[model samples]
Target: MSAHPTRTDTLVIGGGVIGTSIACHLAEAGVGTVLLERGTIGSGSSAATAGVVRTYFPGSPLTGSLAVRSLAAYHSFADRTGTPLGLERVGFLVLFTEERQVEDFRREHAAQRAARVKVELVTAAEAARLNPLLDERSVLAAAWSPEAYACDPAAIVRGYAAAAQEAGAVLLTDTPVTGIDPDGRVRTPTGDILAESVVCAAGPWSTAVAALGDVHLPVSADPIELLLTDPPDTPPATLPMTLHADSGLRIRAWRDRVLVGMGRPGPDESRQAWLGRLSRLLGTVYPALDGIRVHRGWSGALEASPDGGALIGRHPSRPFFYAAGFSGQGLCQAPAAGEIVRDLLAGKQPWTDPAGLSADRFPAVAPSLR
Candidate 1:
């Protein structure tokens, strides 16, 4: 007799950190699961990320609390999964050159304090102590979020994949879910999968899969690039990830290299131009690295939601659910986001209030946050 075809209770598309984290959480909750990926695990944004896990988001629902919990959950993932996860504890240093923005930072800091974020406002004098390389020419105060941190995004995904596999979850890399049927069924590149529920975690490409449900995932893709240098023997001991206010510069130190990114500049410029802009920004912000050469470079695309947050909840029309459009901040929010989805699917308590992140939050015929 022929064996019955493989079937799972749930199907998760996109095997990046988000997808794998969701799959692993569901499996741990005793949900039968199968995760499909278009490429090898961690090949997407998850791998290309510099992994800046900071807790300074302004919004209420997902910005601050989700980050704190997610940071803690990463530790749990590493401990439970037996993987060498890079859970670094470097804090964040955000500087403002404009006086008006410094006031805005104070309000943000106040909100963070209300939200119980371990962050504080510091004077330009204190900021200089942390890194003399800071652009003192543009004098202003800075905010320091001591609880903020970063991790090796690639290692986190790998840990989740390994744990999910150990928990009896089937992981299929290099296979894509081309379609989703109305009856909770998934059509893959090679075969059909009948699942009770499907979780769409396809980062930048989520819309392509969610469209089958008459759901318009308004998220586009744009590549963010970065360059690194040789490791500094005495790395900025705690060279916190610094994000410049007006300049849109994001910087961090790892191993021996300073990994920096120029926040998603408009998509009009050429890739090489983007690289040049970042190089100049880094050089300008830290003159010490002026002649310091770039040893390597990488680019990763991200999806954004209209509200600048992630969509994490059940589909309004479909009984079974999905989540997408993390909007560039998904790396740090993946754990709590996945847990909320997993809980909702399992009918658990403490629901994820996704009103702000509703798909309807977009403008009329909304544009994706690429």
Candidate 2:
């Protein structure tokens, strides 16, 4: 071990969008911050994200509120960060094929309206008019949010990393954290970093990172798969990001190609089987895409919580913080998460009610490493 250890006011343990955003926020607030990443920035789950930006979570009002705030931040991301974020405000749609699903969404729509989210319940015909690529024959109703958007996840991470560096946050890539002590000493192959506070934002690997400190976070890394296909002829003027409620299929126009994402695969399912299921669902949902050639397909692990909401808050017994368990909403909720972590570290009131996102909601399943 080196005789002298590097020190910082705060140490962030991930280089994905979430960690970068937090580092940016901390540095912009004049805090001395150091961020360590196992690989290049955004190389983890953030790289493979769909980058759908919207404020339309039905069951979780906390997620909806966080997304609303995050959307505003993303709108002015480039302007504030002085880095370009390839943002496309193409709107979003949620298609429902069953009466029960419609009923649930109608309640959610009412709740969203009360929260000042600009959304409306529209018929299948109205939804089809908004997105001509969609087949309304089986879709009974839809929830439309015209203010939603899609952007480059990689760019968002890069933007935040640049802004963080500009604000004096030290970023080190290819530096994997091997172990973490309860007193904010992070062990790495290069050296040890003694920080006043530590933040574990390692996305899918967050669970293991926390375990190193004798913390048990009820977060799991689940597989999420996506496919890219050639755009159909006569694509709609505005290609809204669409989600099929019955099938859990997500589709959006990414540049000139159509990006399709499948639902979370079961534990025992194989990748090929999952892809086959997605293919069949795509054909049934959109017959026009029957012969579309798939350009590429890939899978990534998503950090998921039991309730499918984010876990953001401080540790109960230590000077540590975490922002994980975003399920698949990490990309859209990153900005707000940064602010929330910043406030928690500073002992200030967060802009949003973070009680619902506290990691303490989950009981520790293992004995402490101490």
By TM-score, who's the top model here? 2
Instruction: Please report, in order, the local distance difference test score of every candidate based on alpha carbons.
Output: 0.74, 0.84
Alpha carbon deviation, residue 224, candidate 2 (Å): 1.8
Residue 8, candidate 2: alpha-carbon lDDT: 94
- The lowest-lDDT stretch of 10 consecutive residues in candidate 2 is 361-370
Model 1 stretches astray by more than 4 angstroms: 1-6, 58-61, 230-235, 264-268, 349-352, 363-370
TM-score for predicted model 2 compared with the true structure: 0.93
* Candidate 2, lDDT over the whole model: 0.84
- Residue-level lDDT for 50 in candidate 1: 66
The best candidate by lDDT is 2
lDDT of 1 by residue, 226-297 (tens): 767666445666688787877767778766678877765565877667667777877777877766667556
